[model samples]
Target: MHGALPATLILLAAAVLAVVACRQLKLPALLGYLIVGIVIGPNALALLPNSEDTSYLAEFGIVFLMFSIGLEFSLPKLKALRHSVFGLGAGQVLATIALTLPLAWFGHLPWAASVALGGALAMSSTAIVSTLLNERVELNTPHGQQIIGVLLFQDLAVVPLLILIPALANPAGGVIEALGWATFKAIIVLTILLYYGQKLMRPWFHMVAKQRSKELFIINLLLVTLGIAYLTSLAGLSLALGAFLAGMLISETEYRYQVEDDIRPFQDVLLGLFFVTVGMRLNFATLEQQWPLLLLFLVLLIPLKALLIFGLSRLMRSPSSVAWRTALSLAQAGEFGFVLIALAHGHQLLPPNLEQALLGAILLSMLVAPFLMQKRDALVRRFVASEWLNESLNLTQIAVQSMLARNHVILCGYGRSGQNLARLLEREEIHFFALDLDPERVREAAAAGDSVVFGDAGKREVLMAAGLSRAQAVVVTFSDTHMALRILSHVQALKPGLPVIVRTFDETDVDKLKEAGAVEVVAEVMEGSLMLASHVLMLLGTPLNRVLQHIRSVREERYDLFRGFFRGATDDSDDPSEQDQPRLHSVLITEEAASVGKSLGELRVAELVEIKAIKRRNIKGVEPSDEVVVNVGDVLVLLGRPARLAKAEARLLEG
Candidate 1:
């Protein structure tokens, strides 16, 4: 027991360091876990023993992983993606297996072992592909949808494969009888659990939830998951199958999201341990001697798999670019491949040397996956002439639309917030051009006569074609900080002085965006809170004028741009003289201007215009004191009536 504790600590410490390094390197955490296992396992440093107890604990990871997959399983989702999921996805899995089976058989492997190897080789990394796609904001793209659908089908395939692989290990040469009996058992157990379990699940959860004790709810959740798993094991099936059944039953209930939230920590930690155990099984000596075999397997895994998927995608009538991208994104072997390989090894269907080689190839393929996905666009553009043509046509369309547009706003996204801003701009008769990535949204909006185009605003050429040089301002309506920073970089390089207003989820990224040259950062959370507070105050009978003043003060404190608004034809009032009310304007102190070295007090324009703020390079919206000296290239933000503002600017520029 004492030795076990130290070994556990060592394992945990190694895992922590590996995961931290992976995070800093922007790689997947699962890869880190695998590396940790390889470095510390019996065949390497031997910090921990390759014991049955550890393997038994790791099996729970598979159970939880299957549970999570079942939680995400929905009949409607599968039906919606039926073509991609069943057609392309099914074809990919079956074809890869069919190709592998013959090769394994020719390599002198038994039929059972060949099938197991084929099943393991057929899987691709869902975790890596999904994360990269999400970070690139491509999850809604056509190829992205197809990639997800294929992954979904692969996840579903694991359940039956788990049952089949074990049955294939039967020594009695009655492989067909064993398979039939296993399938029958799975059907009967699933029917009983799913049909009868569904009826009991909701009411049982309701009763538990009514207890209103979180501890009780959690305890009951574990009981349900593990209890079903035990039942399935007793029925001579894998525990993972039962856990999957448990998750599927819970998915149909109102508590699905809560259950998923509750299960994630368990799923993630256990899944990491599972991958570590798989890594521990690797033999470095075997890898060193069989380098050629490893290379051969890597080729079969990545390029060959990619070719198969690409061909299948073309058969499905996908465009060449879309098919290539989908293929590249899903080319690497997945975590499930490890699970099946480990299971096969346990069943004595796979030899140790072959397993090590397969593991090495899968690991290497995963390491190469991120780079492949990142370079997919470049590759597609180089190889697929149609991709370049499509991009050229898109840019041409954008340029033609904006050729006659001057002083127009460039909207970076056309989602809900962008649409609202567009409507307000239209009401005020302001010219605006919108760029959106969603093809359907762009088509529908353009069909309704909206000035929008299908293009990525982050691209330099796209922004140029959208009239960035002639734009009055740019508004980034999407709340992606990374993409917003990229757009800010392009804007600063192309047109330094044009104001770019960015929207974010909260104040967490306000300073970051501002430092990147955004003139204003609007936080939706802050706006929502202000609206909530204002409504509450009004409901409490606070005077309207007082409430408005409070809201304005909050805005002024939070946003530099809210200090004043530029006067326009839209600023109407009962009296015509109100049009001359104090408004904001910016004056640039050029090197040749009279105000180049003047102090704020010596400006001699206080009565004409108030100095609201001074914006210098790398600093924005700094309040100017009377004794503050002005320098060349400074931007003076002034507030006064239009005629007074004109005089103030002339005095500052020409003395």
Candidate 2:
């Protein structure tokens, strides 16, 4: 018990210290976890003596990680990026395998072992790439989307690879027959899960939801995840595969977000444990003895993988910069390489020395991952400036169309909602341009002489191509919250005073959209509820005028009653624009402003009108900081008559 206490202390202490060090250095915490494992591992300080326990935790880590990955696996998203997913993704995997196999064979590995090694090394770490991309706020970028598409295919390929590995291990007993049986079993299990499992899961989730017990929901989630994994194990497939399938099944239901929110804390901790286990398995003695060999492998392997992925991206007609960034981002050997090597070693497929060497090589690649990704922007611009220009040629259609329209409304997402809006605008003799991703929708709309272009609205170039500068207003008609938020940012940045109307399915995003610069957010859920309440009031002997007044009151308060019932005071903020009569205005002080270092009292805006609260970026808001010196990023909230407020706003802006 005393020994166990010390081991626990060592593990916790090392992890904390390493994580702090990495955070201070602006590196991912994953590297810190790996370092912690190495320090406590048997090959180093030997604080942890039992590798078996770590291995068990590591397996569960992979399961939860895959489950999280599966949540993002929507059919619509796949269909939207079919070209990249199928063409570039498939090409990257097969090409890397083909490239790596010959090298492995040249190193005197058996044919079966060579193929397994190639496949293992070909995969980049989804856990690492995704975490970094999200943190850097690049997940929605074109290259970022391509990287995810390729990673999705890589994750799906793991199921077949899991089966293939076992067959490779038993080649003497008719590998083809073993693989066939395993494949057949996999198909049957998947079919059962798809056909019946989805139906059962929806009701199970509904039942859990009805109970309204958070504990029961969590317990049920664990049971479903583990049960599916156990079933897959019995059918001779990996537990991670089953867990991923379970996530996919849950994703089709409404309860997936709740499930994800609940599982995240567990997944993160276990994933750290898994990386620690990988670190523990690293033999530093071998690395120290063959430092040059490790360096050689890193230099050769990372570039090879990057070149292969880059070539594939180029083949798919991606811009050189985007292709280069994607290539560099995924140039590392993945976590699965460790799992595959461990499994191969267990099956007596790899010699101890070879396993250690491969481990050293993989760890080296992972160590360089942060550097490669961090410098991705600089690297792309430095090398691919010429290709960037060539890619701009494809925007010719957008340019020509945009030049034809001036003072036209730019409508994003030309779906049903957008089409309806267009019809009304057409009847009013209003000129408008629409941008949509669906080729069929764009074509159909164009045939009817509607001004529509095939492009992503979130892209700045696309928005510019839609003549954003010449637009009277912009309307976003999509239910995608992130994309809508991004589009709102672009619109606000380009034209701060432009009236933007955004449509959403529910009231959950009303405030966020408003803050993001949407002049009006039309939430269908809130509107429907209002209509229902009006009808009920009229039927219950209430006056029609009174019912209408109540609804009007609710809108005047910005649906405050609903917000108070659901969201609470956390959403509260004093916006001067919401005031009656002359609207309130907030102006941000910039660095070059003449009043950058001046206090509110010095600005003397108080004489003209009331100075409301001042909010500093990355700091708490203060109530009328009269004596407080104004910083570059400080937001000054002012309310006055329109004429006086306009002068005050100009003073702040000029300053």
Candidate 3:
């Protein structure tokens, strides 16, 4: 017990010092904690007496880390990026494994070891990348989103790889039967966890959460994380895998955020311990003796992996400027390499020297990760300037559409929402460039001859590349409020007084976004108000002239209204445009019985509206031309003066 006290004290002290150092240096605390472990480890100070205990804690940390990742790794996010995460992710892993296996075999490793090394090396550090992105405030950036999507797919990849490992371990046995048994156990465990664990965990968490005791909350967190982790491992899987499952289960509950908050302190501490243990486990003696082998591996293996990533990214046709940097950033070995190598050693699947080589290779790669990420730009520049790296960089720059003019529009995000807005802008002859993160969408738009910029709006560099520095007005059509605010702030900082319109999925985010400098906020809930204000005034028997006047003024004054909505007591900046006289535009679609079969051109809507399109319910397709007919299920979308739109509704709809 007395020996335990010194160990505990020393560990705590190391944690404190490392945390402080990390904070001071603005680096990730996890890296600092790892350094702490390396310093006090047996190779260094030798303060820790029990290596086995550290291993157990490290195992627990693995469970908790995966669980936390699962909690944040939402089903909703997956659904949103399913095509990329699953499609690209699966392709990358398979291609890497297939290509590397023969090379490994040629290197004199057994086929199983070759495949195991391939699987281990193919998986990147989701945890490390996630933390790094958060630390760098890049989570919502296009590159950040892509990295995350790819990592999630990588995590999902672990499922198949897990099943494959044991089969490879027992090649003589009937592989199909072993796979079936393994799958059956996995399903039973998953079903029981889904059916029962969820049922019990939430109410139990609620009760614990209601206690309002921080100590109890921390204990509950560890219990849930460790308990499920233990249960899952008992069913024949990595504790890390179980932790992820447990997190997903808990994520379904309302208490998830609370659980996350409560787990923070424990996560921080245990995560530090985990990294430290990882560092301590590093066999530095061998590294010091065979520095040449270490250098050779770093020089040979790192570049090979990086080149593979670059080629894959190019084959996928990621952004011209971004692809190389992305490959360089993620090309290094991740935490899974350690797990796979250790597992192989435990199972006697690999020789000790080989395992040592892999471990040394992995640690060295991790040490290089921060440098690679930090110097990404310089590396990119160097890669572009280098004759060796110039092949990939010499590819075409992103095909961009021009949005040049005073009052030129800038549409950020080319998702479904942006697409709809672009259609409207097109009909209006509004010259605007649509910025989208998806390379495919950008390609699609380019092929279609639409003006689009394939870049992230969150980055000042990307935005500058998109001509946002000269944009007359910027419109954010994506749903991420944090990202929207960041764009808004940057736009305002770059060109003060630029009118920026932002879209919000809910009214809840309106005040926050507006306060962040959005000139106008369009919450989807208020969409009906555009139609509602017209009818309500007509029903009230207000003069049509007055009604039209009110609606147009609202449309024009909305920007000013939002601009001044949050001024504090001492703030004297009132938007002057809100005080302007009302102006109205009326659109009335006349529905004549005879005009129903005719398109807008035949109806000569130009006599009523310069622009209008039919809005179809639950569908996305263009309205037919004058030569084509309008059927019963269409609604005319006419743009004109308030009175004109109201007056021509019948003519527009019928046409």
Best candidate, TM-score: 1
What ranges in model 1 sit over 4 Å off? Answer: 1-6, 539-546, 566-655
Error of 2 at 6 (Å): 4.3
lDDT of 3: 0.67
3-106: candidate 2 lDDT, tens digit per residue? 68988888888998999998877677877888888888999989897457668877898889878877878999899888878888888887877776775557
**Candidate 3 segments exceeding 4 Å error:** 22-26, 131-142, 159-180, 198-218, 317-319, 378-655
TM-score of 1: 0.90
1 or 3, which is superior by lDDT? Answer: 1
Q: Per-residue alpha-carbon lDDT of model 3 for 1-655, expressed as tens digits?
A: 8868988898888888888987766555766766777778886788875377677776666566667778977778999877558766667677767766785556786677777777877877765677666655556555667677778887777656765667666664575677687788888888998899878988998898799897888777778787887787788766777788878888988978878887776666666677787667656776677677667666866677777767766677676445666677677777766666656665666666566566677766876777778777677776665523543222223223343333457788888988888888778566677777677777888799887756667766566656766666788997777678778767756654455788987679877776565656887766668679889989989899998888767765654342122111222224554323222222222344545666656777667543433423312144436664555544443444434544565555443
What is the RMSD of candidate 3? Answer: 17.0
* Ranking 1 against 3 by TM-score, winner: 1
Q: Give all TM-scores, in the order shown.
A: 0.90, 0.67, 0.59
Which run of 10 residues does model 2 get worst, by summed lDDT?
562-571
Each prediction's RMSD over C-alphas, in Å, is 3.4, 7.9, 17.0
Runs of candidate 2 with Cα error greater than 4 angstroms are: 9-29, 66-87, 130-146, 170-221, 231-238, 241-266, 312-326, 367-386, 390-580, 585-604, 612-624, 628-637, 646-655
